[model samples]
Target: MKAREAVSRVLPATIACLVACAKPQGGGPPRVEIRPSDCAIPSQPLLRGIHSIVAERAMSCAVLDQGQVACWGVQDLGRLGDGFEVKRRDLPTRVPGLQGVVAVTQGNDATFARMADGSVRVWGPNRGGEFGDGSPDYHIAWAPRAVAQWGTIKQIAGGIPTCAIRSDDKVVCAGRARFRRMNEDTAAPGGTPVVVPGLESAAGIAAGSGFTCALLGEGSVWCWGMADAGQLGNGGGEDQDKPVHVRSLDPAVEIDAGSDTACARLAGGGVRCWGRSFAGYGLDHPEKWLRPVEIKGTRDATQISIGDRVGCALLRDSTVACWGESSYDGQLGDGSDETRGTVAGPVACVRDAVQVSVGDNHSCALLRDGTARCWGSGTYGAVGDGTHEIRKIPVAVLDAVEPAPDAERCPPGTTFKRGKGQDDLEAVAEWCETPDGKREGMYVGRWATGQKLQQGGYVSGVRHGEWTRYYEHGEVVSKDRYEHGEPHGVWIAYSLHWRFAFASCFDHGRRVWQVSSEAEANQKRCP
Candidate 1:
């Protein structure tokens, strides 16, 4: 249940159906007094890859070593598809015509790609069918189709009734109507793609939030639609349209799920999990296991992520371990948000690791030299590290391919120098370009020994007037006022001995109240 709680209020996944879905980005990323009215929408920020990470919910898309794919968080209903929909995009854009690409998934609203000729595409705002193509829409598709004849596919799983695994392994699914009942003798065709009844050879698939699982090549795993928390481990909570065989677990090579929990990866590597949501594996509250358990010291592992609030594993020495619910938001990257003790520890700064995903409260890892690291909640920037702040441990993913190389190149932003300056203290960062780059004026950021940390006044890229944030040693951690990017006047935020930690007032960018003293934000105003 710790997917960062904060649904504030609900009713949307196209009329919610009461629960099988309805959780779109709802309010969970601003602390200190917590005025939250329930924001909803659920996600943001992620970049992976020596090659992979397509985390969904609020948004984040990756897959590049050259196979291009970019995306940032919450781009309104177009969800950062990159065809310009505006509302949010803290950076990372590309997603135009796509190319060679090999994977990506984002479900609950669309964004699926799996090409390299095998073909499969799908774009945003797809109502419930989430582009499984069963014909659900509310406008906003904008572009991105290809889901035709079905064959050559290979593997795809974008939760809530979205599956694909062909090339003869057979397994087709599309959106939901509870997956068209698979078959009890043909009553099909209501939403679209069907065939699951006998789940032919499958071999791999994972989708959650409305159920769907598969692994069989004899390793056995089969699951199907919403079991109300037991996450269909087969022990049962009751909601099935067909497939149900998790009992006693089996050969399993690797598997995953979140939003009701699920984990697997034992052929000897060991690491089991079952749903209804995490709560320390030795168990205390989230009951519903029904079967799959394992998790003690978690063995050799080799990958498993399950996040809606922590459940990592990637061992075999690559290192990574996680338990559950870190007090409130750390999602257990470990640096400190405290809360562990059912055995899986170490996740503090990350290392050799090769891949890990977990999203819905943040977690990302993908290092083996190709670099990537992310920690809990960075909101619309989802910890991609360009800064939206909040990271507890694990940072460093400055656009992963841009912004580093000594910095200096601000088309949209980035500029840091090493030499050639009015006393180049070795820390020179400045942004605010124009001359066709669109932005103009000033945006400083320093720290490589120079220490300015943040300055303000950006133009076309928005952020107007005074802003300041520092702490590399110069103290003063935040004193805001923006007009272009909204949030006008007095925003505060500081606490490392300097005090205040909250003080807000804003105007153009909204916020009308927030206090922790600037004398309680100057006695309060806005009414």
Candidate 2:
């Protein structure tokens, strides 16, 4: 099953877990639509010095060299962990209040940040007890919160129900227990994290929408959860409520699970996959495999990732080869969108690729240079570019480093012009104003879709008057005053629903006061 289809199937249960919450925010840029395509920037790089990369349904995040976490794409339900108020960012924004983050992963709309200290922090939609916070309430976790008192976590994987590997090599899971993947016939109250019975000394674990798999210390593999798609690889179509060993597969090193399929890297550098065989197990004809089957045309595969329908392998030569459902969104990254094929080939412009991650419609590759690139579906910023446009080839994920000299060059109304300090990363050589070469006036920028995306007054390339950010749907998301490029006076952030989320006062560049969803307090403070 495709990840999108899996999401829709699980949506009802997710929505049932949600609860209302207060809002919070402050004004900054023009509002983009909260929709999949509206909130992205155009052709931007998102992260730098990336040590690891993780991809979810339509979002991607990375862990930097120093354990800092950055994520972009699909900020709904606070999945990005930047904050709840941010709809989406095409470029990666560092997840706040975290350090020493060794790894990251995601469920449908949630993120798990694993710290070096062996503790885990989780955020985003808490539906079906995926947050593992021992709470039954459904809500968006605007920030990373501790997963109750659990700690000593070594590895973590996210899914409809997230799972983790503790220091003792025991596996623990939290989330919906419908498939009994949690190993207990009856789920613990409040989705508390619990040990998977009789499972220990595991080397790695992978979580899927409704299943989990583990690579044991002895190089054996075990799986549980819904096996209707043959994902369990136990030579049967029946579901297993507890971990069951698969015959004829041992010495496995790594494993990954998709919506309805799973893949493993063997001790000999080959990859084998089973489940929803239409996705391809290296055969000319799409057929389901009840047991592990080697993916043809692949060898020396150091790493592998499975998308909803597509799959990719990172060969030892640092190139990527993708197959299955390649046309769904250029997920194959071969420059053309072919509907579906069993033939795996090299991805365009992907070299020195150390790690690869595949999402529902897109995929990303982390290079040895510590930079990241993505291709395929960009709708929802899945490609990590700043726009909703689809990419036919790899594009750099905007990094925090200095942008290219031309990056600041704005279009028409906000065109970039030569100016002093133009080379400085903080310099805004571009200004927003009348298009007739006018220097002193307000400027407006509009999208090709014909909606105004930005409007603010400027003087000599510097903002110097009232600025308001609007949502792509025409609702105002923020209002603030600026004095010569610096924020001043009242700053307000509005939720996508047009509700007051946060209010703040800025003097020059420093904040005077801030309140979370307390519009009255902000009004009085600003007044």
Candidate 3:
């Protein structure tokens, strides 16, 4: 076929499949390559049968086929989650205290895992309250801790702020008060997780350094938080505390949020990106993109990931394409430490990649054979190749695995439990007293762990009057009014920071109206 004719025949399908069918994953022999002197060869064999991979600021975490978790990268602040005793790892190491993990993610200073039970666990620094456990004096979770009572969680993403999506499609986020829960009182330090009000029916969620974007079940996208660089994709340079729809882009199959930028893969296999122009998706401006723009000459994008100043796309043909900001670090995996301009093109020497993840200054691809390869900045061993040297070409990661699954059981160990309590008042430490300070005949109370089992006036063991649920930090996580054992008046939910997540008015146990915040309630004249 003539090259010109071939190009003309597939006008809209910019990607040309070099082979009739992209070869299935995991067939080729490991490519022979020289080892860098800075990296020490691993003593163990590479673990096979990998499943998924994710990266954060300068670390990477992966889930094995048998549901174990492994991680590597800068060891500061417990980013690797290997424990406090071991500070750094140049190759993949099993993250202690995690098992039956279905999904894993990393942030600038933390790591997260979604276990099979739908619960989420967090480790590393709790600065800005990213831990979501609602502890007041805790600074770091050197060991992973269960995130209170969350369950049915499907997806997790980390960044400046961290976020996750529940199986029910509701979005919850912790850390970073910039996207403060609309309004209640003061911005609470992120000591717990709270629902991102106004977001529902979401399929996936991604967090950037300061912003967040969610892909809805119907293929539309919504973004909130910082937009000074047009990262919100709402065609305006205004920060959105609530999700704003990305203009014109729809039927999005997947979405990724990066530092000051975001990208989405459409149903038809085209990819559109908005925000920082360094993504090289071919928008005219080199500074910001206020709306989604197509990367010229790209198609069949099954997945797209964005990083600090780079972006990569995994096409259906098993090959990868990358563009943007490769001048100093060869993160593009294209055999050169040079920029690829505003257009996305193929990366050389990598094929049969089943999945790919991009971090701040590096990139990784998981091949069909269950092996992983990484390239670019190796600072602090972010490359997972046991090296501090930059890799312009793809290099193998130490294949590593964790212990096999035992049986269904609770995660052992309990130094602290943040946001965990029973609904009943069986272990009441103190009962609720009336306004006059008289102990009520029957009332809710606190547990020995300081978690409020129930907090409300009760008569005949039935709830009445004002009620509240307190997180471990002594902040009211939720509150509502009750009358004669029936829900009545206004009800409010707060994030870990004690900011209003949402509020609703109820009458005789029936919800009458709801608002995202106190300001929104005031605007609507909700009494």
Candidate 4:
């Protein structure tokens, strides 16, 4: 059967069978309801053999096991590394003719894998030469093809572009040269890989959203690509197509990149960051840091991973600390939705966190004991817990296995955090709160500044009057006369203790008259 037909014919029955087989241990089966009526399918005998694999968002993911690799998600650009841009496959599918695979890396729309023999295979989104096959068009490599020019490949990284280092300590990259374009007179299309100049003996490489960096044997760093956001770490806004030394970075051991920033781990077990600070991913300051700024007071950093808007560091003590945009589902793990402009406090998700990976909207931490925990946006099953639920706290992802004839049902207090595409505000809010009342006052919604509160004005927090004035700093400037939080009469404002600044008459929060006085007019103009 065709892929779509096969999915349509198989999905309903598989869901029903799985639902029916799941019964609470020590009790009768709980109520199971399949809704939307039209999409329902009856259980069939053949469906019993099928199983479903759940993921958070279908980006690009790969798993390496026993020298073999399997990948899935968004293959429109051939990112699945399956040798063809057929379509998206929701489940993990093995790449044809690939074996002895040891490691795999994914880009926004491309994929690359390395073999035990030190050979590399690339496939999927080739819009830029991210595939390193010297082609501009997306090429699906169904089988492992030897990169004849690159030998003894030791490490590889991917982003909007792709880069890899050979065992002999040479570096190469492919994709749009965002940093290089900043200096060149011509627009360079992303396709065709290029050699990064000035680094003849590099030991490692890391790629960001639009840039790439490398670590040399001498403990220095070089980077290139989109520096518009200062991702190149050169302490300047100019983009560098060729590799240039990153200023103020020393004793560097490892590096990682985000959508618009990069982080490096020093030999002393400390961490430093450069690039966009809008989400606090960069160092705290008014000016963009071109040089590395040591993360204040952190001295045990062992590993680091950069996300689209957040960056996380793993300490030698096995503790994890994250900062940067914590607004979207608390991906920063600060126990609040407030956007942190710097590395806040460390989080206590698990002990002995041996590995970590940061996605665009979520993060994953792997325990030394083989258990994995994830947090952030679950709109696309990115949390991989069998449901589309946004989780402010970490949730466990159960390994996929065939359902038993009598499986246990979901436990009490267990509720699926509805996916992002699904509308369920209550569920989303509940997940954003900490068990202890820490995040109670926070609300994740929209607001319009400088707008008058109407009769039916909505406020997430406390509001004492209908015509409340606010300072430019988001603080409550003053409260006007009110009757049950609705404006009733003339209101006056004062700057200091007895110094009247402004006066205004209002009818139910709508301004009606302003006193013709200099002080009142000045307050209205400034406040």
Candidate 5:
């Protein structure tokens, strides 16, 4: 990038140092910026496959297809969940102890995950009881741990004193969460998740800077907590300790709350937001709009997410659009740093997205093919491509995978790897080659981050034995047995949280039966 800049006054050694330092570090591939004319989506069948993503200011987290969570960015306050050994990670690192995760939420100082079994896990500071574990408020979590005993939780909303929605559509909050459990004046239970009075049939929840909002089954919205910037949506500057009805909001199917701002995706696929804005969908100005205002051109939004004074929506046609504040630091992913007023526009150079998450200075989109792309500031590795640079356009979250040259890299009758570095040495995948330069014995593939992707065994030059694919967190994706490169025996596929998904029995490369539930697989036998 510096090659195009005017540096005639620089010394030769200094210039060389600048050029050398710009090279990819930590086993990352060479940087290549995608241009608008020929932007192509990169394929990453092994390392990508991110199902959903959640982001805060400098940190971002995504759920892999196997229900494992990978997080990166600033590791401050133990938010990265790998402890304080490193200041930051420029690549996605698995969050230890988290498996079968279906949802994730990031608070200002902590993070939360809801498991497939309807339980919840949390990490980071317990400041204000955000962990919901009933621990000391000053406790700082160095690893993931279970939350307070509660009912089956469907979702978790991150904030000071996080909140959750149970399978019964009842809302309960933990930590410094202040909703009344009994009456309007009764305070919410601290250190445990307490039910929020008057909130039932809740479908989704959003935790804001100092407030919270919920989307009910009937499409109505309710909010509580600090409302100085019209966060309560009641046209008042007063604070609320109990659930309060929000006015003028169209029946919404989804809701998101950010610093002094909140948004909702209407039943008809339109987007409306309220809070700090002089006019239009929303803005960062002091005058707070107490009522929701519709943003034009977002009538096709299927999902809505907002950050500090910024917002983005995943549209029905698999595209993403952004508005509010400026596209500062390229967070809007529109191919430029052009500042905007209230006009909304589509994000360029990426498509087929199922979900989009907006952070303060960056955004990430989970594509339909199970891969992901991120844009804007790469500081703290929020971009997840093993870099710390600003990107105006969308970039792949995974590095490309390729095989090593057999003649030079693979040694006969010995374990072979890509490199001798520390990260490479720990790679779970290694293989051996026959004297004639054909792969033999164990075969496994790993991502650049040194996580096992897939593993299988081979006899001579043909595939044999059991083969298994894994997520970044080491959860099994699929398991199957093969004989002489043909499918044989039982083959099984697991979904989020390692839950039994699909199973099929085969005999000598022939299908016998397939089942969706574990009971059926147990009763049927391949003949």
Candidate 6:
């Protein structure tokens, strides 16, 4: 069965169990009857150097213990930064020889990473000089090469093309001048690196699927490139080949972009989103918010990350909330597989969430405790548990570093209260019925002992033919042949409970029935 279908079936039962357990009269959380082997707690040696991170476009990413980065996904033109022209890498491998990386950014197939020295390196498909190497050839740089034109880079952003900002405040870009095409006059003279016109002292840059935006030191925003989806936040559908001011935004500290949407976080910790509502990342309400629409109910948002189908915000309280499509897997972390168009209910897997990142079908959060947990699709081991098992809850990737031990044996007679008893007696009775009449003719005792209570072929309250009595614990308490509910023929009795009160055979409904001399049974009288 498909994972979604399987989850749908199992989730209802699981939810029922949870709801039943939460009731005041009901018991606490149901005991999970998992075997020791099923827990699979790993040894510490296997957890060394495992770094879990998120990337765009369902891409595969790897982060070294020292923070080096490499990624591969949707590389139609070698944009996956693997120094290859292949379509995609189904497996993850290290990027040849790159080190001392602090952060990474990706756009389509091209990738850029910032190093410890504040230098930036880029590779992959560079048809428009988006590789930042002053070349437009579609060649893969197998080794990390420095972008000499831009230095002291604090942050980097890439769209259809690539752009970066230096610590000194200047913005430089390399790639086709598609953003200039919005004016119709400066339609890119082929592919070349050009300084974005008008902007100086940029504090940050954000790149969408096709457009780019920059947060300036003056507390204003500017955008360029594809505007078909209003991703530029310029309140117009026309593309901007050159940088144009986005007057709608206030002084912003951080900005994020998805396939066709852009959002910014204000200094006051309020968030405003624009572009591509159809993708469900723009705003909860309809009407195509060309300008910034304040994200409802989100306050103290310190960090934000946007994906093609979802968005997540890290709050100052160290909590993370997400919204948008969660169908691909547990990407939303709302404890449901259904897609959500609005903000998700809060989740509390960790105490102090420090960093959050969203992928096409997965998400990861770094906690203040230096631990990282991930959820969503694990088809590519994106959850980083060393296994590809998909989880709907945030699972510690480092928790299971070693293989599970052998399965342990359990003693017999282990009875577990699976869940609450339904008030529907008919349903409960039907559950105790067996194919043959063997278990029928049993009476319900004062206490439930897991025994099946069933009636055999009977008329009124009288029992006839073979009649059996069961121990409340599901064991046979006695077996007797009866005529009209009165014991007849051979009768046997057992003990453990009720001490086998009586064992006798009777004619009709009364008279001295043949009685067993068993110590416990003969000591009591029959009713």
Q: Write the per-residue lDDT of candidate 3 for residues 1-527, one digit (tens) a residue.
A: 00000000001111121211222122211222323422232455664556777766667777875577777776665555543223355667666546678777776467777787878877777667666666533366545677864556777776656677877889877775446654445455565566787777988787777888888999998998888989899889988788889977778888887778888888877778888887444454457878888874357777777777878888888888776778777886765555654456665556677677888888887766666678888886777776788887766687433222321111223111112122442111222334543321111211112222334312122112222332212333332332311234555544334444455564533345655457776655333
Q: Rate the local accuracy (lDDT) of all candidates.
A: 0.56, 0.61, 0.60, 0.50, 0.61, 0.51
Q: Please identify model 3 stretches exceeding 4 Å from their true place.
A: 1-44, 85-87, 136-138, 181-189, 279-285, 399-527
Candidate scoring better on lDDT of 1 and 4? 1
Worst 10 residues of 6 by lDDT: 1-10
Global CA lDDT computed for model 6: 0.51
Q: How many angstroms is residue 10 displaced in model 2 relative to the true structure, after the best TM-score fit?
A: 38
TM-score of 1: 0.31
**Which portions of model 2 miss their true places by more than 4 Å?**
1-46, 178-187, 278-284, 339-342, 400-527
Q: TM-score for all predictions?
A: 0.31, 0.69, 0.66, 0.59, 0.67, 0.60
**What lDDT, from 0 to 1, does candidate 2 have?**
0.61
Per-residue C-alpha lDDT of model 5 across residues 1-527, encoded as one tens digit per residue: 00000000111111000001121212222333445443554444324656777767787887775677777777766677743224566667666556688777787668777777888777767777666766536766655667656668877777755777888999877766455433455444466677887888988888877788888988899988888888888878898887788866657788887777888888876778877762324244436768787776688888778877668888788778777655357776665555433445677666677778887778887766666678888897778776788877777776322334444333346444322112222222333445554432322221111222224211111112122222212333222232311244665544324544446564533445656567887787766
RMSD of each: 20.1, 15.9, 19.7, 23.0, 17.5, 24.4
State in Å the error of residue 507, model 3: 70
Residue runs of model 6 more than 4 Å from their true location after superposition: 1-54, 60-67, 70-96, 180-192, 278-287, 387-390, 398-527
Residue by residue across 1-527, what tens digits does model 6's lDDT show? 00000000000111000110111111211222323333233444222242434456555454545665534334344344433333343334345446677667766555676777888776655656676665666655433456775567777776666777777677766666445543344433434445676787888777766677888986788888778877777788897777777765677877777777777888866777787762343344463547676664456788787776667788787777666666647676645565445443343353356667776677766654444566677654556554465666665545221111111111123211111122321111111222342221222211111212343211110122232332312233232232211223334433323344234432322223423346544464544
Q: Could you give candidate 2's per-residue lDDT for residues 1-527 as a string of tens digits? A: 11211100000110011011111012111221223232233354446567778777677888876677877777666677643243455556666566788778776578887777888888778887777777646866666777744568878778756777888889887777534444456546646777888687988787776777888998898988878778889988887878999756678888887777788888876778887763544545556767887765456788888878878888888777776775456676655556333445666666677788888778887776676678888876767766667775666677533322332333345444432211221111233344565432111111001112224211122222222232312333332232311245665544324454445465643445655455365355543
lDDT of 5 at 243: 73
Residue 145 error, candidate 1, Å: 23
- Report the lDDT of model 3 for residue 355: 75
User: Higher TM-score: candidate 3 or 4?
Assistant: 3
lDDT of 3 at 438: 35
